[model samples]
Target chain A: MSSGEAGWEERSVARIVPPIRPRKLAKVPFVELAEGRLQGVVSSGSSATRVYVSSIEAETHDFNCSTNNNRPCGGAQGSFHCKHLKALIDEAVKQYGLERVARYLKVEAAEGDDLHSLLNGKLVKAPAAVVFSRFLRHLTYLKVPAGSEPLPEMHWFPALKAVH
Target chain B: MQGVQLAELVQTPPGVDEAMEAVAGFDAALADGLSRLGPRHSEAVDALAGAVSASPLGAAAADACGELAVGSISDTELSALAGARAALLGAVHDALLARLDGALGRTRAEWEEHPADAQEPPANLLAGARSWLRELAIAGWRGVDEELVSAADQTLEALWAEPRLRRLAVLLDGLAAELRVSCPVATMERIPERRWADLWTRAVLLAHSGSWTGGAAAVSGRLLPLGVDVHEHGTAVQAQLHAVLEPRGDGPVRLVRAAVAAAKVDTIVGPEVWDLLSGHPTLLAAIAERRAVDIADMPLTADGDLLWDEERAKAGEPADPFATARVRLPDAEAPAVAPLDRHPVRIAEPVLVEGYKAKRDGTFDLGGAAIDVDADRLPPSGPLTPQLVNASTACIGLLRWDAGRWTLQPLAVRSVAKKQPVEAHNGDWALGPTDPKAAKALARSGSAVAVLTERAGKLLRK
Candidate 1:
């Protein structure tokens, strides 16, 4: 599509989901695991997607997508874009502005010992990614420890190289 | 002599003293009536009939005269005299009963020690209650006759009906149920009347204690979680605890024992309870001994210090409560503010002025610019127009540097008149200036801003 056409199309797509829809994702079950990683699940009827997001990196994530009458996507070859991933990304963008999410990704990719403090400071400005991940984690059925120190052997999201 | 006295006693006028005396004399006469009348039945009967004929209570006496006129004191005539004597005795007994009934006003302890000495059965409800309570205090629950038990049951039922007394009744009922399960009658018999009285007194005191704030006030602490069937009776449990736990002579021993019992039942009580229990030095020592036994497996010196001083070393620095107030050494100097190396300034660009402040003068600061706001650009009333206030994006403006000062001049303003950006879950954009109708459409769709934004961004790229 042409840039103007694309913009129009984008506007049309944005109109599809109400402003409240992304906010309602806050009600989703998710857990903040050890090292600040997140694990969650989202399902519609029998179709479900288990999402894992990285602790130190925002772009790095893996999802197990299963839909009716379709082969399950478990990061195998040709497993790229899925509706679940799109839903999660949409929620993150709406909850956090595009600019804020971009900044968060940049911050996460950069290496620093004071990353935790930095994340906390930046969270006030750009809370969408954290909130989105947390929402996802909340939707998950996995037992998550609360208020306790990080446990050893905590799992992290496997980096997927090919997801669009 | 008895027959003549009976004749004269029944012949007397009705006065308080005279009636009492006559009743007493009649009682003595009736006792010997049959025996005295064995040989002189007719003569005795004649004397009684003549006396009763002149008396106020003479119905029975008059009936006897008919039998005597026939030259015989028949069984029916004897029966009549017996009935008259009983009626007189009842009147006297009622007076005595009323006097005894006044004893109910005395304290329970006094009643227990000094019960009323009534010759006949109680003539009123209060009299009966006092008699029953007195007997109960001495003989325990076993001493409770059917009349007393029924009274007790009725009292419980009445209490159950009342809101205030219902709590005590419920607690008593719970205890009774528990007693039935654990020890039946055996354990209950061991509870003396004094203990029962004390329990009741304590319960009342506790119920009215008016919001006690002691350290161990977690009232249910371990009891609730362990499924320890605490009496759900309102406030009775606390009252019970106050009675049983608060006034123990050996406070610590009592507390530790309670703790031990709770521990045996797999309950971990809070520290406040221990503080109350261990308030005394002797109890503290006992607790210390028990705690020592608990931690005996750990490696420690005879003085109870850890074998390794690593924890003390790891403590790094001991914080003094009055550290700031401590005397400073002479070498210390006062703190100073650091000077900035350069003046803070930003290049000319279209920027969104998020906030503005009015200085002492009426001029406004447009994004930190110390310049006067154009009156024409200002709203008719209030500080700024709603269009400017509501705009999410920066209006096209030039940040100019003139005379070593920053000033902003607006070339054009962007108004979000048609579309208002809805805040997403993360306080981000639901709709932006790029999509004027996006917010309206998204609102119609009834989804979140974040979700719409993500999907729309993808659509734009596609």
Candidate 2:
């Protein structure tokens, strides 16, 4: 498992495409992916978001909108893509390496009429390094603010040493 | 010249000529007796009426006799005169027959010359009078012909009771209405009583035989209104009425058959037509049998509602597993309603039990019922194991009725959780651990062993 993680690091040298930043991956608190099984992105912060996936058919993507918002969705009305879906794809690339991520995203291109031709270039050019860096950043605990005061040390009593 | 010499030699009184003179004399006597009748003339008037009905030529003379009988004709002298009048009337009837024979001969001669014109359609002709000439040429007179029997019988009675020219005219009018023709009133009045009776009987029989075809039945539809006693005619007439509905026929007959099959016979009749259908029990039973067979072939549910039975769920078998027929209830002593499909309720404990069906589609069969397990309704651990061909554990779910079968909608699947048993020592003995081996070792030692429920702690001590 550790070697597989190293392999993902080795392949993540390319740059991320425009409009989607590595910082956005930090904003996504959690991601889960399984081949032909499950794909999800979850965040428990102020801006709550989730994307549950099973099949990657066009009709199945329409269901994702119904699951979250009780409406049909085809990325119409200038809503070109789902943010959570992108987050899930990026996190899968970070965890599973470029080869698995390319296969997973292959479904998106095959099912979407406009995306298939465009996604080939994006998949080949996407930087796995940026995906890993953003994923690792979220795993670290929250840091204390630099201006916070330090705690005072406690003094031990000398009489207790002999009693032991 | 030979014909003229024969005619000159025949100077003696001819029989027909003499009979005509006698008829004239009887008419004069009947008028005289009627004008001066006393109580003694009753028997003679009755005798005269009977005699007039019996003889073909005396029919006209019988008219006056009937009128005198209704009048105040009386006295022994008048009675003697009535007998004389009746004898004269009989002679007149013979003369009338001779006159009819002569007319028929003349008509045949006319037909021989212009055959088609002689037998023209009898528009506005009397039913009894239109074919008088032709009938005379063929049969001579009315009584000898088999076809004239019923007409002769009925006409004799009708003329006897009301022997007047006007009354005879009315009866001929009735016959003409049925025949749809007009006749000269004089010819109708002269028609023998037998011919009138025969016409009525023929019309009725023709109507009765029209059971198979709707055409004649439509014309015969008026029989019930005419006071015809059809039921008395036996099975032949009743069969015609009963089978008004045809089995293989089309149009009106088919429609009538469908209606009769669906309705009870008693409900189909009105009070007006009851007399025509009253005496036939066999006909009703036959109709009921036909109805049962027809209903059996219809696509119907056990409750008698028509439906298509499609076995969509049970492979090639029927979706309904229960018998759909009505069963007799022993306790109630009546027929029970059709039974519905039912299944045994599943009692699955939380513990994993074998013998339940599980599938990868997240479905199972419990107690012979198909069940769907919803992901949301399942426990957080989901299924602890992949579906086993021979399942040893089960989870209880709700039993639902759907499409004539019971289905189970699973709420949760029982999971397998391993339990760890702890062992502790009590003095020299190993105690109350669920380990069977430790307990067995102590048993083999033959030394007294104490079992502690918890870590060898002191009991009842401060």
Candidate 3:
């Protein structure tokens, strides 16, 4: 039990003993480059380690990733890049440790590429900019609030949309 | 020359004179036959014309003549008659005209003054008069008005009746009026009494058959006015009346009873009552077996009230003995040491015992030796042992051992047992196991022989 506690301490060591100067960026207002719409507010509380891109015009494609390219071009087959993904990554890095955020982003990027490829030609084709625009409008009408920042980015978003 | 003379005589026969004379003779015979047959033919023509003019046959003949004139009559006889009447009337007119110098007016006037009456009656006198004329006019008539005669005939037949039927009609009209006033409908028509009776009877029958609502009440109420006592007479009368009125089938006694039972009335009538009465013979049986009877009122005597008061006063008197006190004995307790020689202890009354124990202070343990005796039969000892002193008492004698021997003592006694030789035995033994050793010892002592015999008998039976 002592060793297990020590191991937990080691894994959470950075969180308990935060770095003297944690990487951070200034809080920025989220904006869709194409639509010039004020989408939401973004803060660099803990998710400054990774880059995140969000779009009010293209909700389905908006995403957070290690790289600036939201699309998983190399291997992102069935990826769901959305404002929620961006918000979650930002949340996870801010609330939890950056190491977990980085690890989470990498795994999510690989899984997203695989899913994108698998469902490329199916009825549930990845929503490109055009479909994303429609989805964004729908979400805007529904008024779905922004998700928590620094979310666990390693969690895979299922390709299945709303069943109904 | 002689031949000439004979020829001259024959020559004279071939002259115009001889031919003229022969023609004149033949004309005269023809005229005579014509005169005779012409009058008879004229008479026949006159007779036929009169018949045709005066009777339906005359009209027919006239019509036949007109039809013949227009080439419509094809019958030979009718055609001949028409031709003959035409000729006769024409001849008569012509003759009259000749006599009146061809003045048609004068001739018509003379005929009108003395109109021709044939020797025989018209051929269709009965058929040709007003009846036939009317028939002719009606034959050509059209429209529903043509049925007026037939309609009138039907109306008359429908309205016709015997005196009894008329009376019935009157009664029915009156009854219908009454019914209308009593139980009116929207539309009122004076229905005959027989019809009303029939309707009422039918309604009642339907009610009996369970066809109408409140039919039983309606029937009974209606029947009551007719002097029918449904409840008293039973359903039989109602049923018979129903059969008399409507003769359809048996009255619905069952339905009526069910209805009456539903109504839960003291008295019911009509079919419902009949139904109940007929179905439940138990009702009649209960009535027959009714046993409750009312007591008659007591008659008042001159001194009845006074006597009753005196009796009551005597009963209210107080009893002679005011109060009573009962003294109970204490129960017997076992002694620590059994008496060497059993001395019979007599208990005059029941008692309650406390407990048994020896006393202190060098004195004998009298707790177990205290004995209570009757005050009247107090022993010489001062107090009785505790074993004898079964329970507490206000007045009693107590005995105790001064040295170590059993003694007798007396206690206060409210009463004592009337019998002598009061038996004393160990209450424990009396209530506990029947030991044969004790029994033999008792038998040897020759005490309680009856108890021993009973115990022996009980052991034998076991």
In terms of lDDT, the best-performing candidate is 1
Compose the digit string of candidate 2's lDDT tens values, residues B1-462: 012222232222245344333433333233222444445444444444444455553554455455555652322223333334434423433333233223222111110111111222222222333233123222322222324322332332222222122112222323432222112122222232222222222222212211111110211100000000011000001111111111223322110111101101110111112222223232222221221112112221221112211121011112110011101000111111111100011111011112455666655544443344422222111121222222324443322221112233332233333643211111011012233553443344222111110101221122
Chain A TM-score compared with the true chain A, each model in order: 0.32, 0.32, 0.21
| Alpha-carbon deviation at B40 in model 3, angstroms | 99
B142-230: candidate 1 lDDT, tens digit per residue: 33333434344444333333332322334343323222222222333222221233222222222331111111111111100000001
Better of 2 and 3 by TM-score: 2
Could you report the DockQ of all the candidates, in the order they appear? 0.01, 0.00, 0.00
lDDT at B347 for candidate 1?
18
Name the lDDT value of residue A35 in candidate 3.
30
Q: Quote the positional error of residue B65 for candidate 3 in Å.
A: 99
For B65-127, candidate 3 gives per-residue lDDT tens digits of 344334342333233342333333233323322322221111111111112222332223212
Judge the docking of candidate 2 as incorrect, acceptable, medium or high: incorrect
Q: Give residue B388's error in model 2 in angstroms.
A: 5.7
The best candidate by TM-score is 1
